[model samples]
Target: MRVHHLAALVLACCTPAAWALESFVVKDIRVEGIQRTEAGTVFSYLPVKVGDTLDDETAAAAIKALYATGFFKDVRLEADNGVLLVVVEERPAIAQITIVGAKEFEKDKLKEGLKQAGLAESRIFDRSLLEKAEQELKQQYLSRGKYGVKITTTTTPLDRNRVGINFNVDEGRTAKIRRINIVGNENFKEKELLDVMVLRTPGLLTWFTKEDQYSKQKLAADLESLRSFYLNRGYLEFNIESTQVSITADMQDIYITINIVEGNQYTVSDIKLAGDLLLPEEELRKLVKLAPGDVFAREKLTESVKLITDRLGDDGYAFANVNASPHLDPEKREVAFTFFIDPGRRVYVRRINITGNARTRDEVIRREMRQFEGGWYSTSKINQSKLRIDRLNYFTAVNVETPAVPDATDQIDVHVEVKEKATGAVMFGAGYSNMEGLILSGSVAQDNIFGTGKFVNLMVNTGRVNKTYSLSYTDPYFTSDGITGGFDIYKRVLNTSALSSVSTFNTDTTGGGVRLGIPLNENDSIMAGLGLENTKLDLGPNSPQRNIDFVNEFGRSTINIPATLSWRRDGRDSAIWTTSGTTQRVFLEAGLPGGDLTYYKVDYQLKWYFPLTSLFTLMLNGELGYGDGYNGKSLPFFKNFFAGGNTSVRGYNISSLGPRDANNRTLGGNKRVVGSIEILFPMPGMKNDRSVRLSAFLDGGTVFGPGGTRPELEGFRYSTGIAVTWISPMGPLKVSVAQPINNNPGDNLQRFQFQFGQQF
Candidate 1:
C-alpha cells in the first residue's frame, strides 16, 4: 500500500480543475491510515452519507470538517468504485513528561504549568503547545528577575504510538538591585523619599528583608507609597511619570530609575461640606478633624471623610458614599476642599447566610454576629460581628460580604464565611527564671468542644519549686444572653526554697470555684464567684518567724470559704496587640463570717495604651492592693501580697520585696503598689511584624507590712529595663533586663530574667 501526504491528496480531491472530479454515489465508507481512532468516528464526521451523491465541494467540506476536530494530524478523502474512503493520521498521545534541572520551581508546579498549556501526560502531543509552555516557563522565571534563565524541550517516540516529552530548565540567580535613582523631586530629599519605599538598593539588612531584590509587585507598591508620601506632605499634585528597570548581562545586578512630578505645596484655605447632611451640619462639621490654614494633607482629608461616613453608617446608612473635591490655586499655593456626600437607600438585611464552617455549628458563629436578619443594616454592627468572631479564636479567618439582592434595591444579604482552625491543642511548655530555675508544663485544651463553643482544659505542671494540677471548663453563653459560666479545680504545692526572701516552707492548697460573668455593656462586665479551699502549711527549721507565728496562732491546717466580686472595663482595639485603649478593673475578695479566718482584700488595676505614632505605643500600667484580717486579727502570712517579678518590679527577685523578719527573711506585706511605663515598638528590620515586640520600661513598686509606716511611699524600689515579647508558634516568650535605681542593703535583686517556651 502507498500512502500520500494528506494535504496534497485533499488538495487534489477538492480542486475540480486539477482532479476533474465527477459526482458519484457512495456505496460504502472505509477509513484507512488510522492507528488508534475508531472507524465509526471517521464515518460520523462525514457530511455525506454512504448513499448520498458526492461532489468536489462535498468532499472538500468533509475533509476540512475532519481536520477541524484536532484529533487528526491529516485527513484525505478518496473514491473507489463509487465508494468513499477517509484516511486519518491520529495525533499521538503523550505517554509521560519529565522535567529536569528545575531547582527554582517544584517539579509538580512546572508540571501544572505545562498542564495548563495543554501539554501534560496522556494528553495529545503538539509541538506548538510545547513551544508555548517553554515560553511561559521562561516568562515566569523572568518575573523573578532571572534574566539568564534558559529552557529547552525534547520529545522521544515510544512504543504503542505514544511520545514522551522532557523539559530541561536552567534557572539562573535572581538579580540584585544595585542602585535606585529618584528624579524630579525638588522639595523632599531623595533619601527622605526613598525611606518610605519598600524597594531599596543593596544594604546591610538586605539578606533578611529582601529589599535588594527587584520585583514588579514591590516596585508598584513602592511607587504608590512614594505618591502617598508626597500627597500627605502638602504636595497635592504629585505624580509618578515613569519607572525604568535595567539589568546587567550576567543577570546579577539591577538598576532602577523612578521619575516623579511634585507640584507646589498647598495650604488649606477653606473646608466645607456640600452634600446633604443627614445629621445636623454642626454635628457633621465636628467630625472633620481638619481645619483651614493647616497643610493640605490628602490623608487627613480622606480620614475626615471616612469619619463622617462611618458616623452615618452607624445610624443605619449602609450604602453611603462621600467624595472630597479639591479646588487648587497654583498661584497662591492654596487649596479648598468640599466633601460631597451621597446617602443611598437604607438597605435592610434580607437574609443572613453562614458558610464555610465545616466543623463548627452555625449557632456558634451566629451567636457572635451583631447584625441580624430582617433588620436595618448597620456597618458598625457588621464590622463588630466580624471582629467578635475573630476574637473567638475558633477560626483562622472570617469574612463578611454584603451583596445586594437582585431586583431589590433596598434589600441585601449578609454572608459570613469562616475558615475553621484546629480548636484543640496539645501544649507542652518549658521555661527558666532566676527564681524558679527550670519549669515544665503540659496541657490539653479545646476552645470549641464538639463544635459547640464550650471550652475545656486539663493541665499538669512541675517546676523546681512549684507543682500544680488543674481542670477547668467554661460556657461563654450559659444563658443564651451572653452570660459566662466557668469552674476551676486545682491542687497546688509551693516550695519557697529559691524565694529566700519568703519563708523557707512549703504550702499545699486544694481548691475549687464556680464563677459567673454578666455583661453590663459592650465594654463593661461584672464577675462574681465563690470558692472553698483547704490549706496546710509545713514549716522547716529554717522557716521565718512570721510563718512560724502564723502556724502557731491559726493552726497549720485551715478551711475557708471565700467570695469574690470584680468589675472590668476593656476598650482595647485588639486583645493581643493593643495600640490604643484603656482597661480598668476593681476586685474584692472576702472570707465568709463562718470561715476558719475572717479577711478581706481589695485591689485596683488600670492599664492605658496611648499610640505615640503609627509604629510606637506608650503603655501605662498601675496596680494597688490592700488586705487585712477583720476583728483585730492580722493578715494571714500566706495571704499577704509581695512585689518584684517579671510581672511586677523586674529588678528584684520574685516575692523578695518588703520588710525582713527577725531571721532576715522576707516577710510578705499587707499593702502593695506597683506601676510601670513602657514604650513599645516593633523589632528592628521587621516590616509590619506583630508577633514580636521590643519595649523600654520603667518599673517602680514597694510592699508595706503593718509593722512599717509609709513604707510603700518612702521605700519605693525603682528599676529601668528593656523587655522583649514574642508570640511563638508554641507559646509566648518574655525576657527582661533591669537595673535597680534605689537599691537598698539586704534587698534581693534579679537583674536579668527570661522565660522560654518550646516556641521562643
Candidate 2:
C-alpha cells in the first residue's frame, strides 16, 4: 500500500511538469499594445535575451523598467515559444505651451526663462514644475505693482503620443496710489510737509521715474525722513500715530492716510557755555551762528558743537568733547541751550589711513589731504581736505574720520574712504537754431585725467557760417597750494551779414592763452590770463567803405590781450532739477597792452530757481553784455555780441533777435540784454526720473546801438512758447516751438528750434 501511494505522488508531480512543457519556450520576441513606442525599444528593457529562459518573474521586471522611462502610461510583457516579448504605451509628448495673465513680463521672455526650470515646449510635461513656474511668474508681476493678475494653463493631446499646452493669462489693472496724507504737524501746513516728501501726485512724467506711483516701502521711508527732519529741528516729542493704506471699492485705486502728533515748537531763549576755552568767548560766539532768539534748529546746534570741538582740537586739544543740551520752556515754547566742553588730552597725528580707493592711486588721495602723519592735527585742515576731495569728481562720496589711540590719547589716526565714479565723458551733438543754423558741436573731457587730479578738454563747434576748435588743459594744484592754471589754443572763423549798402565780411582768428586761477575763498575765485591772437579780415563787395578802409589801414594783423575776472555762487539743490537757490556770475574782459586791439567787454548773468511743488519748478535767467573800443576803432566784428536762437529768444531767428538790416537780414547786436522765465514740469507719461521735461517760457530782449546806446524796452521782442526737453541716452535734447505774442508789421508768427545735445 505504501509503494502505491508514493507512485501516486510521483505521477502527480510528473503530470504538472508535463503540463508546463506544453507552454513553448520563446523563439522570437513580438511586442503589442504600443501606440507611439517601437517594439525594439520595449524589447531593450527586457532582461531576458532570445536564447535565455523566460518566466513570469523576468517578464514582470521588464514591464516595470519599460514604465520607468516616463514615456509610457502602461507596459506589458509576455513570452511565447521560449521568446520574451514586451509592450509599452508611451505618455503624450508636449506639443505646445501657453501662458496667460502676465503683463509686467512678456510671454516669450517668461517662457524662455522657465525653460531653465525644466518646463519647456515640445517635451514631456511635468505638472509639478509648471505649478512652481506659475507662482514665480506671479510674484514677479506683484513686485511691479500688478497685484491682480491670474494665470491658467491648458493641455491638449496631439497625434503620435504628443500633447499641446496652453496657458491663458488675464492681467488685471495695476494698483496705483490715490493719495498720501501726513498728520501731526502744527508749525508747517500739510501742503508744506507734503512738498518736502519725495513722493507726489502722478503727472506727465510718472512713467519714467515712477516716483509718482506709491509703494509701501517708499512711503515708509518718506515717513521716516519726515520724522528725522522734525527731530533734527528740536521736535523731540514728534511721533507718528498710525498709517493706513486702503484700496478703493473699484479695486483700481489706493489711498494712504498718515496720522502724526507734532510736538511744540522750540526756540532758543538763552545760551551758556562750559569746559575748556580754546578761543575767547566773543570769538566763539561769533563762530556759533546760533543766537538766543533764533529758532531751535537742531542741525545748526549740532554744527555749533562740532565747531567748538574742532576749535579746541586745532589748539592741541585732540581729545575734546563738546556736548549741547536744550532746556525747554513750556509756556514760552522756547528753550535755553547750554554747551559743555572737555579738553581731554593734546594729541598728534600718528598715521593717516586711506581706504576704498580701488581704482585711484594712494598718492592721488594723499596729495589732497591737508593732515599729515607726525604733525599737529588741525580740524580746519581736515575739513578743507574733504572738500578738496569732493571737488575731484573722481569719488562719488568721501568720508574723513579721526580716532584717538586708547593708550596714547594725544595721538590720532586719520582715515579717509573714497567711493569712485566715472569722471570722463565723450559727447557729440548736432542742432539747428536761428542764430547758428545747422550747428554741430562735440566735446571730450576728462575731469580726472588718467587717475591724476587734473582736467583736459577738447571741443569743436561747427556752424553754417562759423567754426571753432579748442584744446584746453588745467592743473588744479599747479602750485601745491590750491592754485589752478590752464592753457588753451583755439581757432575760429565768423562770416558776417550785410544790410543795404553795408557789405558782408569774414574774419578768421587763431589764438592761444595761459590762465592762472587763484582761490580767494571756499566759494569765490579770481582768474587772469594773457593771450596772443592773429586775425585776418576779408571784405565782400558793397561793404562799408569806412570799415573796409579801416581793415586795410590796420593791415588786419591785430594782436589782442584778454583779461577776465569772474565771480560765482552756486547753491542749487540739483543741477538737473533745482527747486530753490540763486546762481550769479559776473565776467569782465578787457584788452591789455600785449595785443594790437584795445577794447573792454563785460557780461553779467544771474539765474534763480524756485520750486513750486514736487512736480513744478520755475527758472528765471537774466543777462547783460557791453563792449566798447578805444583809439577810435570799432570792436572787432568777431567780438560783437549777437542774440536769438534756442538758447536765447526762440521766436526769432538765430542772431536775429537784436537788430536787422534794410534787407531784413540780422545785423549782429553790439550791446545786448536778455531775460527769460520758464516754468518746468515733467512731460506726460514720463514722471519718473524726469527724463522728459516740458516748460512754458517767456522770453524778451534786444540788442541796441553799436557804441553807447543801451538796449531799449520798446524794441525788445517778446514771445511765449512751449518747450520740450528729453534727457536722452546721449544728452539733453531740447525742442521749442514759439509764437510771437506782440508781432510788429511783417513779423513772422511761428519759429521752431531744437538742440540735440545740451545741458540747459
Residue-wise C-alpha lDDT for candidate 2, range 1-760, written one tens digit per residue: 1111223323434574532322335677777667756767666766666665544344445555666766677665444445545545566767777775565678789888778777787666666777887787777666566667677777787777777777676768777776888766678788878866766766665666566665767788889878867876767668899988787765567778889988977777898887676668887787575798876776788789888888887776777888887687888888887787777777889988889987777877888777788988888888877876775657657889888877875788998988776566665554444334454556677777777768888777665466778899998778877788999999988665422211267778899999888877665677778788888888766454444666876776677778777776665554445577778888888777656777888888899999886678899999999988777666765576777667777786556555444434444545889999999888654556546788999998877654222133226788899999876766557789888777575332237767664321
TM-score of each: 0.83, 0.66
Best by lDDT: 1
**What ranges in model 1 sit over 4 Å off?**
1-5, 8-124, 152-169, 433-437, 462-464, 497-502, 576-578, 603-626, 642-760
lDDT of 1 at 529: 94
lDDT for position 378 in model 1: 88
Residue 703 lDDT (model 2)? 70
lDDT of 1 by residue, 152-269 (tens): 8889999978999888888878788888999998988999988988888877878766778788899999998898898888998888899999988788999999999998889999
